[model samples]
Target: MNIGLFFVPFFEVMRMLFAYTTEKQLVNARNATTGTQYYCPDCGSLLIRKAGSLLIPHFAHSAKEICHGMSEGETIEHLNLKQMFYQWGQQTDQQWQLETPLNDLAQRPDLLNRKLAVEIQCSSLKSTRLAERIKGYSQNGYQDWWLLGVKLRPNKKFTSLQKQFCSFSKDKGVHVWGIKKDEISLFYHIYQQDQHYQYSKKIWPSYSVPITTILNTNLSELPPKIILSKQSVLAEKRRLAKRLSCSEPKVMKVQTYLYLQRRHLLYLSEWIYFPSRYSFFYQEDLLIFRLLFQQEAKNADTIFKKFLYYRETMQRKWIFHRIEEREILERLYLEAIFCQRKAKIL
Candidate 1:
């Protein structure tokens, strides 16, 4: 028999034993009073009872060893909170309920009483795993869930961590709460399945927090707009053309006109007109114009000339490199115009 294989099983056995014994200790501690005697489940050392607080019974390690403390009380605190919230909701006539044995594979939540399930995550799990678990709950019929994050600290720092949890909500329809120490703060606009935004700096360690409240709101009702303008588009094209060093004659064609229009280049669209030749990019561009502008253009030739002039002026100072010459010159000729039009009075 390989000794290594035996070691693996032995380690597993020890892990199970530790977990089992820890769980037992937690249960006993929860039921014990202030003066009750307790022992560390893992190291068999005497445990220090910290008395019951508003949350639950607390204990610490008397031994200095690594595996001598009971941390499963966090899980117990979560369950207790769930039970407390469920009962509170029922008593207050809130539209919420509590379900037992949350079915994650069934995509069910840890606690689903009403339209949403609540998951209380407080582990240092990966974002993918957390996302998968929440997705499972959503797929199992719970569209919304509250994610409550408990931090290692109980202050403003924990609230900051709650904001960090918002990044995990992308596409997962979950809300986040930051519970540090004893305070509870909730984020309303942060949806459970919203898209995630990342930062270049890595400021904190990764952890998972369970959602606590699932609101009754639709995500699609939010706004959709990119903060770009006609000038920005024109500037980008000129920059690209200059870099390419292409001297191709700039053409104010239909495709270029439509591209700007579709991108909501209202200012650019007003001053430029594309030739009818590039009908495809034009058609797509016209869709955006149709949505934004009620009246169609009555004078196409004059607009096209103005657009041509604008394109030429914008590209006058741009110097294209050999590789980018053709592409950049062509792009420069495709002008974005700003129109002087009156706003429609609603």
Candidate 2:
């Protein structure tokens, strides 16, 4: 089994379990003879195969130039998780490859099986790079699965960067994967309640659940939907009112905008406060956007078109990679219309 590379203490260098010999034949460090010369598959430089009772068999770069294909470094947790995945694949007799390089895409996924490319993210990454890598995989006919490392796990809210990893599915809604020790956590049914976001979590022992089963979870296995209680909405409304009374800079800005449109901040359309999980990704202020939609849209028939217009004219920032912009906007519009009608009845 190929273990790829892991951070080694000696000389503070990464030692890969796979290498190539002078004949250009790939060799696993466990099988390669110590006296035989091995070369880095990526850099094509001489490699020193290290083996001992204290250390796992691996090959380290003979020189200082690190492989450009990998990240600057891998955390111990990251490497261990990768190893665990490899072991699980072996146990299940699945054809999984580690650090498979997609030469055409110029990207190397942590693990690959057919069209599925799994990326393990253990540390903070620039959003632009994340977007670029995702696009690259998608364009090259591969599905990218990002599993967040322990440090990148969401708490109260997902950071803008973490939001980039989220993918939408009809069954799971907006969801992301995180590694919690030896368990895999699925944070699904993520929805915005009021000013805060909530999600239902499911956990499975790393080897207990098959990777395919997790990836192919369908509506039949859907988690229960999150309910936004009236009390939460009321509390959020009170918070908004308090902020306005205190003249908070951000809240005052929204008030000024509403004033220009001849709309009272305290008496905006009820849809402006409707909860939506998808709309949380919108760059524009959610309440302001809802108010504008309520004002400009004639009825439900025109809501979607009007939203597309606003999205184009205002140039909203799109961060969710897998979810379509129209899908999110349309869902928000319908949810708003429903909320508006519900308000009228109450």
Model 2: CA > 4 A from native: 1-17, 45-67, 219-234, 244-253, 298-316
Pairs in steric clash, model 2: none
lDDT of 1 by residue, 239-273 (tens): 33453354233333323544565642323332232
Q: How high is the CA lDDT of each candidate model? A: 0.37, 0.71
Which one wins on lDDT?
Answer: 2
Q: How close is candidate 2 to the true structure, as a TM-score?
A: 0.81
Cα lDDT of model 2 by residue, 292-346, tens digit? 5677664644665655554565555677876787777677776666666766765
Model 1 accuracy (lDDT, Cα): 0.37
Error of 2 at 210 (Å): 2.6
lDDT: worst 10-residue window of model 2:
1-10
TM-score of each: 0.33, 0.81
